[model samples]
Target chain A: MDGGGSAATIDHLFRRQHGRMVAVLTRIFGMHNLKLAEDVVQDAFCRASEIWKVDGLPENPPAWLMAAAKNRALDAIRRERTARNFAPELDRLLRSEWTVAPTVNEHFGANAIRDDLLRMMFSCCAPAISEESQVALILNILCGFGVDEVAGAFVSGHAAVEKRIARAKKILAASGMLFEVNSASEFATRLPAVQRALYLLFNEGYHGACAETAMRTELCREAIRLIREVLAHPNGAAPASFALAALMCLNAARIPSRKDHSGNLQPLSDQDRSQWDRDLIAEGLRLLEHSASGTELSQYHVEAAIAAAHANAPSTEATDWRQVVSLYDMLMQIQPSPVVALNRAIAVGQSEGPERGLMALDAIGGSERLARYPFYAAARADFELRLGHRDAARAHFGDALAAARNPDEKRYLAQRLAACGDVSAPLQR
Target chain B: MAEFAYLYRGGQRPSSPEQSQQIMQKWVAWMKELGEKGHMVDRGQPLEQSGKLVKAGNRSVTDGPFAEAKDVVGGFTLIRAKDIAEAAELAKGCPILERGGDVEVRPIMQMNM
Candidate 1:
C-alpha cells in the first residue's frame, strides 16, 4: 500500500510519538534496557516516514505507530539468543503474549503509559546529578530537545551540553536506577530536586533565546503539564509540586505581556498588566494558597507568593515591595543562594532605600556563579541609579550591555545608561 | 508471512580491525538467536557503505553514500513475519540501541515495477 496516510500529521508527531513509545516500552522492558526500548521507538518512526509516503496516513496514527513499535520490539527479542545475558527478566516478560498487541491500549494501557512517562521524568531528574544536568537530560529525553536547543538554554556550547547529557545518562545507568513512580515519602525526598529542574526548564523556555519558538513553548507547557500530573496523583502530589506549578503559572501568565507588539522584551515595569492571562493568574493564586496551607514552606512557595503579588499589582508603582521583600527573606532562609540574595537586594532597594540594598549586596561578597550573570550587573546599576551615582550607574550599565545575550536586554541596558545622564564625556572602561 | 528488512547502521567511524571483529562476533551471536527462533527469512549479512541513491525525476544518481555518519544507512536484515505489526515486533530486540545506533524496519514490497 502507498505510505501517504501518515505524512499528513503535524511535524513533531514522530518526536512526540518516540517519547510515548519509549516510556511504554521501558515500562515493559525495564530501565536497564532503555537503549533497546528507545531504538525500537526510533525504528518505528523511520518506518512510518517511509510507508506513510505511499500508504497515506492511518486512521488512528498514534495507535498504528504504537502497534508497529511493539511488533518491532518483539521481533528483535525473538531474534536475539543472548537476550538472556542483558535482560533475562525482560526476555521472560516478552515471551508472554499479552505485551505485544496489535492495539495500543492492548499493549500499554492508557493510564499505565502516562504513569510510565511520569516515572521516566522522575528517574531522569534524580538528585544524583547536578540540577543543570538533570534539566538538560529531561529536555533531551522527555521533550526531544536537540543539543543546540539545550545549549541555548544553558548559554553554552552545544558540545558542552551534549557531554553533560551523556554524562548524566551514564550516571543514571551506572546507578542501576529503575523507572518507577515513587511513593509519597520517596517522592517527597526527591521533590525538591525535581522542582528545581522544572523551574530551570520553565526559565529556559520563558527566556526565549532558543532557536525554535515552538520548542520553547513546548518546554514551558511540558513542565506545566508534568507538574499538573504530579499534583493530580495522590502519592506524587506534594505542597512543593503545587507551589512549583503555581510559580510557573504566575510566570507564564506574563509570557504574552513580556514581549511587546514588535516582539521586543518589555521590562516588568513597562509591561501592560491588562495583557496578562487572568485565568492563569487566578489559578496560580489558588495553587499558592493551597501550597501555603502546609506548615513547612519551600522556596517555591515563597517564590510563588512573590510572583503572585507581582501579578496582582496593577502597575510597577502599585507593587507591594514590603511584602515582596518579606517573601524574599523567607526564601533566603530556605535556600541561601547569592542569586536569591541579589533578588532580595533589589526588593530591598525598592522597599527601603538603595543604600540598604547596597549594604545587603556588598555583604554577600563575590559569587563566581553570578560573576558573568548580566542580571547581577543590571541590579547593581539600578541600585547605583537610585542612589544618584550616575557615573557608577553608567559604567555598570555598560557592563550589563556587554554581557546581555538578548537584543532586547541590551537595548534596555543602553536606555538605562542614557537615563544615568553621564553624557558629558564618554564613560571610560 | 511477509519478509521485513532491518537496516542496521553502525561503524560510521573507522574502527580497528579488532573492534570490527568484536562487532561481527556480536552480530553472529544475534543472528544465531534469530535463526533458532525461526524468525530469520534468509541469512542476513552486512554490506559496505558504498551505494548510490537514484532520484525519481531525471533518474539522477547521487555520489556514493554521502551523508553524516549518523544519517547514513548502514546495513539490513530480512525476517519473516505475519504482518507489518509482527515485523516491527521483531525489530525491537536488535542490539543497535546499545551502541547508539538505529534500525529501520520496513515490509518488503511484494510487487515490482
Candidate 2:
C-alpha cells in the first residue's frame, strides 16, 4: 500500500464515515443513547486507525467501517441488553440473538444510513434548542467536529462549547421526537429552523470573525455538504432550501479571492474576479432558477439574488448596483436587521450616490445598533472617500479601525485611513 | 539491519471525531514516512485493554492491562534500524508520543534455532 495514498484515504473516510456511522448507530440506539452511539462510532474509528495503520486501507473503506461499526454495535447490544434499554422501537428486536444482526444490518444499509443522517440533521436543528446550540450540535454530531473545532468555529472556549453541545443534546434526546419525516406540514415548519442553523453555520465560516482560515473553510464546506443532504431528501427540496444552497454556493465561489496569499482581507473591489470559482457560480445560478418556481419569497431567495448579481458582474464597477439595492430592499422586508440596513445603505451609495447613501444610512431607524460593527463605519468611510470628503473619510476610517476585530480587517481600515491622509493621491472610486 | 519494537503506551481514546481522525491521519502518515525511509518492519496491532494476565505458577489469571491505569501498553510497531540509538530515534516519530504516550524502543534480538 502506498503510505501517502492510504493516509489521505483514511482522512477522507474518517470525515465521511464518522457522522454516518454515528447516525446509523443512533438510529439503532435511539436518541437517548446518543452518547453511546457516538462512543461506538469512536471505537470503530480507533480500531480502524490502529488496524489500517498497519494493514493499509481496505478495498472498500466505508464497507470496512460499516462492518466494524456493526460488530461494535452487536457487542454493545449484547453487553448492555440486560442492563439497559436500546432505542425504544428496536429494543425488543435487538435483545433477541436471531434478530440482532438483521436489525443492526437493516439500519446500517446504505438507504437507511442516508435517511438516518437526515433525521439526525433535523434532530440537531430542532427548534427546541437555541440557534447557536443547534449549529454547534450539527457541527459536533453531523459534521464530525470535535468540541475544540466547534469552539474554534465560534471563537469560544472549550468548556462553553462542550456545555452548549451537551445541553442541546439533552434537549434533543428529551424531546423524544427525533423529527420523524412522516408529515409534510410538520416538515415544512421544521425546515426553516434547519435552514437557519445551516445559514448561520455557513456565515460563521465565510465572515469568520474568528481566525484560522482553514477551520473557517471547513465550516463552510460542512455546511454545504449537510445542506446537500437536506436537499437530497424529497420533502427537504423546498424553494427556500434551493435558495439557501444557491446563496451559499454563490458566496462560496468568491472565497478564493476573499483573501490574498498573505491572508490580508481583500475587499470586493480589489478581489481578483478571475479567481472566483466559475463552476460554483454556475451551479448557484441553476439553483437560483430552481428556487424561483415557488411563489413564496424567502430571505434566502433575496439574499441569493444579491449574490447572483455579484457573481454575474465582471468587476465591481460592472456590477448592477441598482439590482443589488432592490434585492437588499426585498431582504430588508423579509429579514430586517441593522446588518441588512447597513448593506442596503452601501448599495444605495453605489447605485445612487455618496450623498444619497449617507442620507439613507442616517435614515436607518436603528443606526446606533450598527455603531460597533466595523463594516458600518467602513461603508460610511467608503462613501465619504468616494465623494472626496477626505476629512470625514479619515474620521469614519478611524472609527472602523477601532471597531475592527480581525487583524486583516483592521489593517485594511488602517490603510484606508492612511490613504485618506495622502491628499495628493488620485481619488479612488 | 536489526528489527526494533516500538511499544506504544498510555494514550486515552480521542474525545471527539475530529481528534480521532487527526490521530488516525497522523499515525498513517508517520507509518508511511517510516516505510518510505526504509524503517518499517511490521505494523503492529493494538492490544485490547482487558486481557488475561496469567501468573507464573498458573495459580491466578486476572483480567487487565487495565486501560484506566496510567501507562497501559496500548499498541506497537516494528521497524528496521541499524542500532538501538537509530531504533529509538525512529521511535520518536510515533504519533502516540504526541498524546504524551511513550514508545519503548527495544531491539528484537536475532536468534538462531
Candidate 3:
C-alpha cells in the first residue's frame, strides 16, 4: 500500500470539499466573516491530518470533515465576543436557541452546498474584480489554495501573489457581495469573465515557467476540475467555455510527454506520441464537436481545433501543419496578440519553409510586447537552426537564454545554443 | 517513561506538490520510528492561529496567545521518553525542521493523588 497514494486521496478530497464547505460556512458565518469561515476550513484539514495519521483512513472522510467543521462553528458561536461580531444576517438567524441549530444545519445541508458553491464561484469572478484578482480569488476562496499554491499555478512570485490576493480579498469583503443564485441572463453577462480566468489558469498550467513538473500538472488538473463546475450548470456552460474546456483537454492530453524521464523539458518535435493520453484526446475531440454546435466562434474554438490537429497526428512530421496554420490565422483574426503571432509563425515554419516562417516572425517583431519574450527568440532560433544559419541560431538562442524565466528553460536554450557551434571558427581553418 | 511536549514552530507549507509529498514522507517515517521505539504517545494535533485570549480579571478578550506568526506555537505532541535528553534527542527527528521549523521539547509534570 502506497502512503503517498492515500495522502493524495486526502488532498483531492480537500479540494473537492473545500469550496462547497466554504460556501455553506460563508452562508452561516455571513459575508463579513468570510475569513473566519476560511480559518475553520483550514482547521478542519489540520484535524483530519492528525486523526488520519493515528486511526488510519476514515470510512467517510468528507462527512468527518463536515462534522468537525460544524462542531467548530458551534464552539465559535458559544464564544460571546466572536458570536457578537457576526454580520446582521447571521446574528438575526442565530438570535434564538430554537432557530440556531436548524439554521446552521439548513445552511450546511447537501442541497444547499451545490447552489452555495455556484453562487460563491460566480461572486468571486464578478465583473467588478480585476482579471488577475478574480483568478486569485477563485483559487484561494473557491479552490482552497494557499498563496504559495496560487503563485505556483500562475507562475507569479509568491510575494506579489500574496499582495494581489490580499487586495482582492479586501475589495470582495467590502463589496458585501450578496449570495444571489443568478438567473440565466445574469450568468450569461458574467460567464465571459469566469471563462477568461479559467482560460488563464489552464494556460499557466500548460505553459508555466515553474521548474517543478508536478506543480504545473496540479494546476492543469485544478483548471479542468473548475471548468467542469462551469459545464455542470446548464446556463453556465456557454459555447466559448466548452471550447475552452476542449482546448484544455487537448493540451492536457499531451502532458505526459511534455517532460522527459529525468524531468527535463521535451519539445513537441521530440516527444513520444505513444505516451499521449488517448482518452483525453477522445474527450477533447468530443468537446470540439459540441463546441461547433453554436455559431459563436470563440478564440478557444480555433485554438482547440489547432490542438486537435496536433493530437490526431501520428508524429510531428505527420501533423496537418496547413490546418494548424489556418486555425492560427483564424485565432489571429479573433484574438490578435504577440503570443498568437509567435505561435502562427511556428506553424507557418512547419507548413511553409523556415524562411517564410522567419519573415512572418519579422512582421510581428515591430511589437514592443515580444521584445522581452524568451519564446519569441527561442522560436526564431528553432527556424534559424533548421535553415543552417548556425551563427544566427546561436545569437537567437543567446537572446532566448537571456530572457528565460527558469533554470530549466535556460539550460535547454544553452544546449540548443551549444549545438549551433560555428564551422567558421579559427580551429576549423 | 515520562511525557514531554514537543511544541512545533515556524514552518511554511511546501510551495509545490512534490515538496509537500517529500515532506509528508519524512514525517510519516519519523512517526513510524517513534512508534517502533515505543515513544509515540500520540501523533499530536495541529493548532489553528485564530484564538481569543480570555483576560486575567475583567474577562476582556484580546486576539491570540501569539499575535505574530513567528511567535506562534503551531502544534504540540506528547511523547514518552526515558528522560528530557531522550525527548530532546527525539526532537531532532522532526520533519518540520527540514522546512526551517523548530521543536521545543519540554517535560510534562505529573501529580500524585
Candidate 4:
C-alpha cells in the first residue's frame, strides 16, 4: 500500500477530528470553558499519536477519536463538577451523577456534533467580536488552526494573534450561550456577518501574500467547507450565501494556475486557461444561477458575476471587459472601497485603450488611498508601457516592486521593470 | 537475522494538530521504510499507562509500572536484524527521537528445543 495515501489519511484524520472534538466538548463544557474544551481535545490527539504509532491505525480512526473524546469529556465533567460549571443550560444536569453521562452522551451523538459545529461557527463569528478576532477565532476554534497558523495567515506575530483570539473568546464566554442556531429571526440578522467572515476567510486564502501554497489552499478549503455548512441549513440558505458560495467556488477553481511550476506568482494574463478546474467552475455557475432567484443584490452576487464572466471567456483578451466593467459598477454601488475602485479602473483599462485607462486611473478621486497598493502602481505601469512611455513605465514598475508584499510578487514586478526598455516588447495581453 | 524488541520510552507531546500530523507521517514513513527493507517483523501495540504490577515477595498485585514519566516505556515493536548493532542503528530512524524519546533495542534469546 502506498504510504503517501495513508499519511494523508492520518493527517486529515487528526486535523478534522480536532475540530469535531473541540466543538462537542465545548458544547458539553460551555463557552466559558473553551480553553478547557480545547485542552481535552488536545489530550485526545496526544494519546492517539502515542498509541497509534505502535498500533499503526485503528479500523475507523474517526470512531476511535470520537470514543476517546467522549470518555475524556466524561472524565472532565466528573472531575470538575464541583469546581466548574458547564453550558448554563446544562449546568444542573451535568452536575448530578444521575444525568451527567447521558447528558454528555446526548451531545456527543452524531447529529448533536453536527449542530454543535454549526453553533460553534456562528458563535465564532458573533457580531460582538471584531472582524479580525472573528477570523482568528474561526481559525483557532472552528478550524483547529494553531496560533502559528493563524499568525501566518494574518502575516502577523504569534503574540498578537493569540491576544486577538483570547479577547474574542472572552467576549464569547461573557455572552454565556452558543448563538441559538435554531432561531429563524436571529439567524437572519446574524447570517450576513457570518457570510462576511467566510468571504474574508476565502479572500485571505485566495489572495494571500503569504508564501506557503499549502496553507493558502487549506484556508480556502476550510472557508468553502464552512460556507457549505451554512447553506446546508434551512435558515442559512440566503441569496447572499449562495452568491458567496459561487464566488468562492469560481475563484478556487483557478487555484491550480495561480502559481507557476517554479512556485512564482502567475498573474491572470500569464496563467494558462486550460489549468482552471472545470468541475469547480461548473459548480460555481450552477450556484450563481441559483442565487439569482431572489431580488437582493449582494456584493458577492456582482463579484461572482464578474468571476463567471471570466470563467466563461476563452481568454483574457476575449473576456467581455464591458460586462466585467458593468459588474464592477454594480459592486461599487453595493460595496464601495478603494480596492473595488482600483479593480474597476483596471477593468476600464482592458475595455478602453491605454489613454482611456490612464484617464480612468486619474479620475478615481482620492487615488492616494491606493498609493501603498502595489497593484495600483503595476496597473499604471502596464498602461504606461502599452502607451510606449518607457520612462514612466520604468518608474511605476520600480514603485510597484518596492510596495510588493512577497518575493513572488516582487519577482513578477522586477521582470516587468526589466521589460520597460524592450521597445519590441508586446503590450500585456 | 534475529528478532529484537524496540522498547519506546517517553517523548514530548505534540503541541499542534499540524505538528502531530507531521510526526505521525514521519513514523508511518519510517515503518514503511523498515518493512520494505525486510526488517519489520511485527508492528507492536502501545502499552496503557495504567496497569497492574505483581510484587515478587508478597505475591500480591497492585496498581504500578509507575516509572518516572520520562523513563516509562510507552510502546514496543519487534523487528528482525542481523544483530543488536544493526537493530540499534535501524531504531535511530524512529520518530520518537525527534520528540526526545529513546528506543531500547534488545535481542530475544533463541531456544534450541
Highest DockQ scorer: 2
Off by over 4 Å in 3: A1-5, A12-16, A50-57, A78-91, A155-157, A422-429, B1-29, B41-88, B96-113
Q: Give the 10-residue window scoring lowest on summed lDDT in candidate 2 chain A.
A: A3-12
Residue-wise lDDT of candidate 1 within A1-429, one digit each (tens)?
222222334445554655567777766666766777767776666555434422345677678887787778667666643554234344555555664333334447777777777777788877678888988888777765557756765668978988998898787666554545656677676666777888888978876455344556677877897688678767666778888999999988988777778766677878988999999999999988778765778878888999999999998778999999999889888988988988888888778888988887777756667767777888888888777678788798888888877666777678777767855644321
On TM-score, the stronger of 2 and 4 is: 2
- Give lDDT: candidate 2, residue A311: 95
**Winning candidate number (lDDT):** 4
Worst 10 residues of 3 chain A by lDDT: A420-429
As a TM-score, model 1 comes out at 0.72
What lDDT does candidate 2 reach at residue A207?
83
Per-residue lDDT of A1-429 in model 2, one digit per residue for the tens?
654585555554676777888888888888888888988888888888778766676787889889999999999999989988888888999999999989888888788899888888888887678998988998888888888878888988999999998999899778764677657887888899999999999999998688677877788888889889989988999999999999999999998998888888888888999999999999999999999986989999999999999999998889999999999988888899999998899899888999999998988897787898899998888888988899999999999999987777788788888999998987665
Candidate 3 per-residue lDDT over residues A58-90, each given as its tens digit: 667789888888877766666643435665667
- Model 3: how far residue A313 lies from native, Å: 0.6
* Pick by TM-score: 1 or 2, better one: 2
The residue-level lDDT of candidate 3 at A44 comes to 69
Per-residue alpha-carbon lDDT of candidate 4 for residues A1-429, written as tens digits (9 for 90 to 100): 454345566555677677778888988888889889998888788777766665566777789889989998899988898998888889999988899889888998887888788888888888789887888888887787888889999889999988888889899888787877899999898888899999999988988677678888989999998999888888898889999999999999999998889887888878888999999999999999889987999999999999999899999899899999999988888898888888898899899878888888888877787898899999999998888888999999999999998888888899899988777877664
Give the higher-TM-score candidate: 2 or 3: 2
- Which segments of candidate 1 are over 4 A away from where they belong? A1-11, A53-57, A81-90, A96-107, A207-215, A367-369, A419-429, B1-113
Q: TM-score per candidate, in order?
A: 0.72, 0.96, 0.84, 0.92
Q: What share of the true interface contacts does each candidate keep?
A: 0.00, 0.66, 0.07, 0.53
Clashes of each: 29, 0, 0, 0
- The 10-residue segment of model 4 chain A with minimum total lDDT is A1-10
The CAPRI-style docking tier of model 1 reads incorrect
